[model samples]
Target: MEKTYTVSVFTENSIGMMNRVTIVFTRRHLNIDSITASESEVPGVFRYTIVLRTTRQQVDKVVGQLEKVIDVIKAFVHEENDIVHQEVALYKIRTETLTNGDVEKVIREHHARVLTVDPQFMVIEKTGHVEETQLLFEKLRPYGVLEFARSGRVAVTKPMKELSTYLEEI
Candidate 1:
């Protein structure tokens, strides 16, 4: 099974870190689905939320390689027990395929918001479980989806816990 794994990497914020990280996957021929990196709560540190298709063994190998890179303070694969994860998806739908009633029905059923109504498309913003996000995509298929963008899964361990916290105790 092509399972999805979310890796949280804490590294120094500097040049070539992304390149180095990406090269690991490229060299292995593992095409990443999505990646989002940004400053973390800790200064001089960066956090990357990478979504990729692989098995548990492959994920472990990837994390091992990531930890060896310079400036990588820590790297870990987050399972459901280790973190709370969520993804956000924005879908643009064509107006032609949807009547007002139909749109309302989908919106109510999925808890989605119509962000804008330009003459060309209607933008919807939804945040929730990955399955829920996928459901929106399925529902909007008949409506001619114009474009879509999703933020990579962002995760932090449950209260009183964090990746670092878990590691420190080890």
Candidate 2:
């Protein structure tokens, strides 16, 4: 059975490394649901978090292939429960919606905060899992959302040991 998997790839900062890492998945015909890259705890190292729906066998193979990339320092595949993750979503809604108390109530109910309120539009921000963000989006839709954007997942493993420790052991 296929399941969602989050692959974390640690690599030395280098040009074109992202392209090479993504090519591995492209070659396998796997579609990446989301991908985010940023500097890791280790100063010179970077981390790539990629989410995809694939079988365990296929994910394992993808991880193995990722490890073969020249700049990849380490790669690990994690089940949803194995890591804690979150995504940020920003919603742009017409400023007029704020005139009605219902919009404020809806925002409060969803636990979203108003980032900015201008004459033209109001910006609201929500940070949570995909479902949470989507729920907020749906609730605000009737109020007229001018724009919506949700970022890729950002995650950290559940293990107590820090990533730096793993890098040292390697």
Candidate 3:
């Protein structure tokens, strides 16, 4: 059965490493739902969080392949329950609509906050799961959403041990 998987890849900073890491998925004809890369807790080491929907066997194979990449120090595949994750979404809506409707109530109900309010438009920020962000988008659409953007998933494993510990063991 197909299920969502988050692949956490730890690597050294290197040029073209991202392209090399992504090519493994491309060759397997797999589509990445979301990908985010940033520096890890350890200085100079980077982490790539990639989300994809595929079979467990396929994901395992991908992780094995990712580990073989030149710059990859370690690669791990995690089920949704194994990690805690969140995505941030930003919505830009017309300011005029706020005065005409109960958009404030809707925003409050969704637990989203206005980051900026200008004469023309207001930017609302929501941080949560993809579904939660999309829900907020839907609720604000009727009010006039000028723009919307959601970041890729950022996650950390549930285990008490940190990535540095794992790196040291290796």
Candidate 4:
């Protein structure tokens, strides 16, 4: 069965490393749902959080292939329960239709905020789980959305458990 897997990979910071990692998934015909790359807590290392849907076998194969890349230090696959994940989204909507109070309610309920406002449009920013972000999107759709963007899932395992340590033991 196919399931969503969030993979965290640590690699040397160098040119083409991201491309190499991305190409592995492309070659396998897997569509990455989302991806975020940033410096890790450790210096000289970069971390990538990638979300994709595939079978357990395919995920294992992909991670194995990723580990073989010269720049890749380690690649680990984490299911939903293994880590805490969050996604951020920015939405631009028509503010003329919704009252400030109504908008404030949505903002307070979802912990969103107005990032920008023009005479005609208001840009709202929100950070939350996938479903929570989607729910906000649905609520704002009625007011007409102008534009939006979402950061891919960023995940970290619970305290006392880290991907690098877990991989090193194996």
RMSD of every prediction: 2.8, 0.8, 0.8, 2.3
> lDDT by residue for model 2 over 7-39, one digit each (tens)?
999999999999999999999999999999999
Residue 115 Cα positional deviation in candidate 1, in Å, after optimal superposition: 1.4
Record all residue pairs in model 3 with backbone atoms less than 3 Å apart, i.e. clashing.
Answer: none
Model 2 residue runs over 4 Å out of place are: none
Which run of 10 residues does model 2 get worst, by summed lDDT? 161-170
lDDT of 4 by residue, 37-141 (tens): 999977788999999999999999999999999989889898888889899999999879566577668778888988888889889999999889999998888
1-170: candidate 1 lDDT, tens digit per residue? 66877788888888899998888888878998888898887768789988887888888999999988988888878666666788899999887656558876887799988888887788999998788999998988877888988787877766575545644764
> Candidate 1 or 4, higher lDDT?
4
Off by over 4 Å in 1: 1-3, 96-99, 163-170
Backbone clash total for model 3 is: 0
Q: What is the C-alpha lDDT of each candidate?
A: 0.83, 0.95, 0.96, 0.88
Error of 4 at 126 (Å): 1.4
Displacement of residue 72 (Cα, Å) in model 3 is 0.3
| Per-model TM against the reference | 0.82, 0.97, 0.98, 0.89
Q: How many clashing residue pairs, candidate 1?
A: 0
Error of 2 at 140 (Å): 0.7
